[model samples]
Target: MTEIAPIAKPDRNRPEPLWHQAEQALRGLIADGTWTDGMQIPNEERLSTMLGVSRITIRHALRNIEDSGLLRREHGRGTFVRSSTVIAGVRGLTSFTQEMAGLGLIVGSRILERDEQAASAEVASALEIRQGEPVVRLRRLRMGNDAPIGVQTAYMPLARVPGFLALEPSASLYQTLSAHFGIAPREAREVYRVGTVAAEDAALLGIETGSPAFVVERITSDAIGPFEFVHSIMRGDRYEIRSRLHI
Candidate 1:
């Protein structure tokens, strides 16, 4: 494979911070496909030498990009470009598989764990179920283009769903619930907050621990009433959160 050249240093006389200059240069490289997704980038020494900045400055620029979800730094390994992941707003109800497919991304998931459990007080409130009611907890590591992008942990009242896990795990959970479980989602509400990736999440998503991420909370209703809730953490770089507003 041909080694990608380091970005040229910016003019030092300019007033911009050295790290910001490096950020611009590196972003250009990634956008132009000089450095593709999952491709390892040059180390701090090389970046410092090529960008004519201190190692600390290079680190700062990389950190900024990583926080922005354009790059990921692996501990004891080098930084790499992040794969693009789509974010579909909950303007209305939608299926996860359909949402990703609509965006033309091949979506898959690693079913980290799945089982039935009693609803906690919070889960009970979200699902509108009695506390200790049986709820199916489906934990999955969501992926796009075969790259880990996010972690989705969903809870659905078992009484409202039947034979959910019997269907393919790769299929849309919402669809399965609607088709066989007769749990068609009619409405949904979502909330988001900036969060840090814990060690478990970081390992599952193939990013550094303490990386910036988005914590998403969602509750969806069937034609009759609400029965599902999801707690999801998404990689900031690979995935974006987008919405539309009407005037």
Candidate 2:
């Protein structure tokens, strides 16, 4: 079989950062189907030569790609391309940030809505709070490696989490709740369903209107009572629900 030339070649003379260029080239290989899933890529030394960069540069590029969940590295075995689709396990009451971090993907959030509102009937019912009770509504566009992954809207009773709205926009909800408010979920129930996202959610998730998506509804309760209710819309193309079954 003939050797396949890399589709993207890093330009040494270009003013752009060399490691970033190398990363783009490597990512291009995977995106274009030249380097397939589970295929072990060249060694750092060989990649350095092919990309016209130093071993350190190649290493940095590989690390970035790996952090995006597109590659996995073994010490004895070489680095290999992971599947482009991200596997999000639903086995626990895990936060979005924690889940992405577990998969080696960088998590980011852009707060789309953060304000106190009287609980609607649906929200009241989910959180087991009285209707018209004040609650904190936090809606965010969740991203993994700067790519849109999901849109999440969470509601928490103001009595349980006072001053939560003052936190930073990108702060992890669970961490802040546990650290500042002394709240933790003792038990949680999550419902997952396949549905199409509306135009607003689709735009936030960077997908087309009415795209296939996963609608996840969750109610997290502490020892005292239910404290949080969350609804999330996850992109179907890039996300998969995974769990390890026990006998």
Candidate 3:
């Protein structure tokens, strides 16, 4: 096992022990993506030195966190953070705006473009419309803390939502549909893949071109019919999807 690095002190006179403080500090770093998955942490001696604590204290802290499934120790290498991918399963009816807001992140959108376009073959097939049917294309970049978090492109049949583009883009599209058309998105079929952020997406997301990104394709519908197709690319570091499963 790699040695733990020195832990940082919490405050001048906090009641917590050096070890517990060290544990929390390390946990924050790992959870916030400051310490990436599979990356070895600094040795225990370094942790002790940095945290103003003894090696024993550092060891105890590391042991606790490791048992929590946040850290994994290799035979010869040091401890590393567990992977940080979020896995929002396709098994529920959840709104992205509500979900992200509940995480205490400010959800905002900047409309990149909105236009009426003839349905492409793929769009037509997904929307179950004729090839030359009109569709509303809305491209947007989502931000949290003024940092780009995800890029989303949504498509809807013009006939289904007559004046959707006229509505403020920053507002929740789903909510607007619900209020105006009584069309609640009851469920969605989502597909996931690993992809590179392209040049345009890189600029919009303020990341280097070709950086790793999570690509999600979603088709949402109500009991009446399918309503929207959304393609989103989320930043790998800033967001994680979570899910629960039962036997």
Best by the lDDT measure? 2
Q: List candidate 2 stretches off by more than 4 Å.
A: 1-86
Cα error, candidate 2, residue 243 (Å): 3.4
Residues 151-230, model 1: lDDT tens digits: 99999988887666676775578767767776777788888899999999999999999999999899988677888899
Report the C-alpha lDDT of model 3 over 1-247, residue by residue, as the tens digit: 3444444576648888878888889877775666766678887888877877899998999987765445667888777765432235433577667755543344677889899999998888777889989999999888753568889999899999998778765458788888877888877888889888999999998899999899998888888777898899988765555455579
The reply for model 3, stretches above 4 Å from the true place, is 1-87, 241-247
Lowest summed lDDT across 10 adjacent residues in model 1 is found at 83-92
How many collisions between residues are there in candidate 1? 1
The digit string of per-residue lDDT tens for model 2 on 1-247 reads 1245954667767899999999888887776668776788888887877777899999998988876668877888778877444676645667888877766566888989899999999999999989999999999988876778888899999999888878765458888888988998799888889999899898787778999999989999998999999999988976777565799
TM-scores for candidates 1 onward, in order: 0.66, 0.68, 0.65
**Model 1, residue pairs in steric clash:** 69-237
RMSD vs true structure, all candidates = 9.5, 9.2, 6.4
Candidate 3 lDDT: 0.76
lDDT of 3 at 33: 60
